[model samples]
Target chain A: MTDAVERIVNLALHLAHAAKPVGHESIRRDVFGYPKDQDEAAYLRMFERDKDELRAAGFVIEANEAGLYSLDSAATFVSDVGLSATEIAAVRAAGTAALSDPSFPFAPELRLALAKLASRFEPLEVPAASRQADESPSDQAENAAALELATRASKRVEFVYTNSIGRTAAHTVEPYGLFLRDGRWYMVGRDIAHDEPRVYTVARMADLMVSGARPKSPDFSRPAGFDVSAFIRLPFQYGDQEFSAALRFDQSAAWRAKGLASGLGVLRSEGDETVWSVPARDDAALLRWVVENGPGISVDAPTELADRLVSTMRKAATLHG
Target chain B: MAKTPASERARRLLAVIARLESGSEIPLVDLAAELDASPTELASDLETLSLCGVAPFTPDEMIDVFVVDGMVEVYSPLPALDRPVRLSMTEARALAAALQGAGFSADDSLVQRLEAATAREFDAAQAERIVRAASGQHAKGVYGSLAAAAGAHRVVTIDYESAGGAGTSREIEPHVLFAERGAWYVAAHCRLAGAERTFRVDRIRSAQENGESFTVDAADAAPRTATPSGDLPTARVRFDAAGDFSARDWPGARLVSEHPAESGDGDIAGPKAVLGPLEIEIPYAGTDWIARRVVARGGAVEVLSPPDVRAAVVAVAESYSG
Candidate 1:
């Protein structure tokens, strides 16, 4: 909790998590370099720091009795949050229903997506954003016109967006990700202005044009490590808390540990075992990770890290059972 | 200058514009009183005339315009009232072409205007051909049908068939009709399905509205209920460069984060890579169409998703394979 402890744990957690399949001794060295007088308790503090740090980083760290740690595939990997089946269904249903809308010309690829979504979930209840949209005729017309253009364009589009502060920026980007952010729909793209990448709110757009330009590709990549929700808050990213913790995993479950993110680094293939080095901004996500991975994965380096996942799992199981 | 012959409309309008522009230093209230027209109407005409300047015929010809204390005035030597000489053949053809692209460009007013203006049997070279190509007649018919239903608020029964040819009869309470993708769709509350729906007019075998009347929505309601580009859930896709799918340009995107595709990191130069190049996220309305498009691109493009969208793409691929 103190600043010094938090700083040390934070560094240790990042070092541990940045690389996948991190070794126990390497993690310890990452924290203490060389132990003073072989004091085991000092090592324990380091472990406490590591676990706490992982929790703070939003990592779910769990240790098996054997002293190896792993991340939970289910808990940390999320494209959607708090979405009910019904909501998903509604989105799918409404989307599919407009297939015939002439203004919004959807290509076969788009139509297939609608059909697929419709089959998966029930109709989603209209969110406040969607309902508010319905309240105005102009909004509906604009959306319709955009749909028509997008359907016919069926290719990448380029748009110029002025930020909330009235700054003008341009993005010659493809149309890839469309999701509502706080009730406003934003189109995510690689910003041509910064030449990096960014998101633009649909409502903020002044003009939208589907150009004859095709999706000219760049040789860039997402680092394979990007987590969409990390943009929501800091606690969910690196180590959850300020302490180091240890975790263990059964060597048999090593193969189950693939790369959770591109930057999580490589999966070291050792004899009958695998270790994951994780840097976390929050430990809750880490804790959840270990509980879900169960006996197969654990938080091995920092002792406290191992203990947290075990206790959380035990509690969770008890509550459910 | 030759003796100017002015019509009643031109004379009345010119007097109004002349007074506003002359700036007799006369107050706008005084001019309205002298003109015997409402100050509001006179002001509006003056304002409109101010915008109507002759293109510079010579260096001395500045745009003849005047604005003062909520009053609009214009100075022009030409007649004050000229409604574009009733649409030149070229212009008529252009309008018709614009209409035909969406398969509808006809209306009762349009018919009346065309009849009164053209009066000729045909202007085959310029206007007639283009108008025909635009399908001005057809689009008008489809638009009129839906417009009538939407105006009447009547539950209309339609014989419908889908892409796969499943025909059914349904009565839907038509609300608004929209033109999209060169077709017309009537948006309404489907009485049988108990939900809002859009019916593509081309898919309808027959449509008839029972005797009914409906209230006109407020003017502000026109845009909000409009349908989107597609009926599918949309996903954002940012591209490195706009690919084969053309007809639009995106100016909003700037940069992109990307990596080599999962299977084909080394494949670009040789046969080592299985997957192709990848780019950032931009929202796309339909994946099914995109999947086929991606496939058709022959390795020029790739799709990236958070996970489920990727899964959906895979599922679509496998299903399509069958």
Candidate 2:
């Protein structure tokens, strides 16, 4: 098998560097990997499979009408697109950091990508970034596998999910997309039994398995206009009913609203305070979020929410008093 | 040696050919580091590549890659494969993920620029939409600037919004940039504080390089623990079982003890099984931050000791209640 890898690589190099299309006899005689004891038919079969693998790896191997093979340099090779120093630094910094992070799902591909771009610039002195806090190696592997299957293979997956309340159940999901939030991976998919979209934390999944029905073809199609970003909501946006809510950041803390809001809702400035109009699905959670992020932030609308805040705070103060 | 998958080795071999085609001699150690392989393994791969050649099988037609005197040297131009191959679907996705993890958006200029080097048939937009790593919109530009500054060891002045809601300007020497919990942070020596502090990249409202550079001291570059130091004041707080709390929420907090729910304990009512209230001792440098966390949980959490912290929590809760 190792020799097969070498043989395939040797065949690719032979064809790519050939001055003109060379026939099977020439390849068999010259390329080092082809087994000398193999008969002509078996040798040809191996050659055809090698070529297909190379093509699948993004190489363009053209077979001329005369049955000779040659490399299409224009299609096979990447042309130089001038990248600014900053762009190179950006890629190198992020790419290097990601490569060292085991939790990052794309480490192997990222390593190859960085290798391709290695000659572009001198390596930056960026240190390796830390992995997500509290992530175990096993969880990282399973999460990466689940994400790979969900996004690239478009496969359905089955897992026993333990929800926040510790209730465990088996679920078969046609995973549509995946996103990273707060260093945790979440898969948004259609639940087979409920026939509705739901988000499941990858860490809470157990005995996860991707459908083996068709390895090459996707098991299900993502609904049209289904964007995973829409599913990644704030801490306060997780209930059945959603309503408009307004929170105000005092003048002193106004600068923090944009970054804290994370582009979720519209933020406007009136006088000195910054008012953010965002969607709220859980009033208790919203109040908690306000208190959690507050010193200068407070609820500004929906009299009921404001009253709840007041009552909750009164209870908190009395508890401490 | 761990067995290298045939497909992965094949891809790596192509990249090796492309890397060596430039005709410059690269040290085997350096090349192995770049390719994420060990030197011995790379040397073996080079030996394997040396036997590959075109139709003639003559010395001139054979691949001329070799490792000599600790350096990889290529004498013959590999021709068609001399240039890098197009970015495969996986490689393209990796690039997008890396950039997005660094806070760049799918439509970021760097993404668009790199997209040109991808295979024409690859659907980058679709791939970007499928896997999102973007956590913050404003952090992208800030991250780029800080990265370059850290690489150059330059002093940068930044407008930072602290966790307590106060905004201040600090000129610091950037040492290392790291990510934890989906946010990027830079550990640097703050001239104002005369100590090394980690600042979240997203909280930096603006950054500008001050042109002056400083050398990083060995101590300054040492890894800083996320936990608060022992000298900081500790606050004892009781978290009701109804509230979802974990040790991770407080970096330096330790669980003191657990008090089982009494028959009439009203705080323990919830659908989930309630174990009781948790007594956690949390260390803090300032009262405001811890107060906000306690008040944010409504009455589920109570500050149990250190009268100042309790007063701070009461003041914060009362400020909103009034």
Candidate 3:
């Protein structure tokens, strides 16, 4: 008997090569997977599953009112985009590197994608870039599994999460989206217990399980306009009360503002200086950020905040003296 | 066989078929490398494909593909599978996520160009919002230039600004591009420094390929840590109870001791009560980097022994006060 993979490929080829929509009798008689002596109900169920699998693989198989199926070539085949050498190199480099990175959450799917695009260009001579940073492979695996369920499978997941303050509790969340920040993975989801959306660190999660009920149907619909990037708060942006903080980057270090801002604040050029107005929730963290990134940066507005920074600096200088 | 999912194999088979449909003979090793699969796996996939066919399993209807002398050849091409299939939604998402991880934003031109090849149902905007891998707004142009130069074995001139706000121009032979923590670094042979150093790509103000090619020595191209070897100078520091300081903040730091915060030692803020103050001995290769970190924590951390480090920390704090 042919395996499921072989059977599915045969079904796809039969549909795609057919001159016209083929009926069920023709498929069962022609496809290699369905056994001739198999029960009628079982054959029908298997055939339906194969078609669904084909659809999931991006093949648009259409059935007419007469119950005939044909592969929609226009939708199934990608048209030539005439990619330039530079564009091809970028895709090849990034795809090749990420495919081998164990910490990347999408290596399996990326491998398939790169394999599909392999025939388009010549083999690149450059070695793929590698990640040298510290990473927890278990955390990455968990993140990938939960992300697939939350986004693609649209299933609810249950896990025990330990918060920053060392508190652990069971949580059932309808995961909406996922984002990576500062070498850590975060999932923004709706907590079933609180009935509100919350972000949880993937590393601190333990014993995660996705809802297995209704494999095809989604358990919940993500609310409209929900974006994971919005939940990616900067280091100093975490706290209850928020305030507008301004910092000035001297002309020498002005170029670093955009990369440091991470698309979270308003940056404008004031003569030779770049002034950034960003939201701050943690004053201490903000002060630390300025010092760590500085020599050319300083607090510019909210006299109280500036005074506090000066005071802190004076104390530091006195102690170091 | 049970370990590998059926759907994954099916995806690989489809790509294999698309690659072989041109009827060109390709070495099994080369093909395996291209598809990121082992030769044995490719051989098994080929055997499976050779048996797959429409009903009746006629010789003409079946896929006539096989490996001859470790080379893949296709005698009977299936016209339907000639063109590569459009990327599935999951595959497209993976591509976007990978590109973002490489410092390319969702709106980068490279991403937009690749979007044209995705399935019609793939929503680029939605994918951008749903999954984000890139942490910050990186200098994409700088990263691209350095990456290209590294690939071509070329020397490029760059104006790099250090964390201390000092800028210098240098010509360097680009070697390997790597990511540590959240930032991208290029390990290159710096002519100015007369050594192989890792410079953060974000700190590079501008990079211009000088059109001069250079050869990289094996030793020079090897990844090097900024930390210097040998008996290094160590600094003893104390952290206040209110600060969330850990050994991770200072690599190669050893915990000296922990003690309860003495009354009137310092003011403690925030909701969490002060557990204790920490004293650590941290080794340093240079005073500049350690001084910046100490000053960054403000008054929460203070340098104890090593008068040079303390003086350096004071200088850094004064630089900020000015």
Candidate 2 lDDT score at position A319 = 98
TM-score list, all predictions: 0.30, 0.86, 0.86
Candidate 1's interface RMSD, please?
30.8
Cα displacement (angstroms), candidate 1, residue B13, comes to 8.3
Q: Which lDDT tens digits does candidate 1 get at residues B67-110?
A: 47754444444322111112223223333333333333233343
**What tens-digit string does per-residue lDDT give for candidate 2 at B1-322?**
6777776777787765777663669899977887788899889888877776655667876668889999999887763466678777778788788778777766677777787677666665677667876656554467767777878888999988775667899998988777766667788889988986778777787888888999987666554444445777789888886766655566666667745533432222222333457777888756777898888888988998999999988888888887
**CA RMSD for every model?**
33.9, 4.5, 4.8
DockQ, candidate 1, vs. native dimer: 0.01
RMSD of 1: 33.9
* Separate DockQ for every predicted complex: 0.01, 0.55, 0.55
lDDT of candidate 2 at residue A96, scale 0 to 100: 70
**Runs off by more than 4 Å, candidate 3:** A82-86, A125-135, A314-321, B21-37, B52-78, B216-243, B256-289, B299-315
Which TM-score values does chain B get in all models? 0.45, 0.79, 0.74
Q: What is the C-alpha lDDT of each candidate?
A: 0.39, 0.76, 0.76
Candidate 2 has what TM-score?
Answer: 0.86
Off by over 4 Å in 1: A1-321, B1-117, B121-126, B130-140, B159-170, B178-187, B191-205, B212-216, B219-221, B224-232, B236-276, B279-322
Worst 10 residues of 1 chain A by lDDT: A126-135
Q: Name the candidate that leads on DockQ.
A: 2
Query: Which window of 10 residues has the lowest lDDT sum in candidate 3 chain B?
Result: B262-271
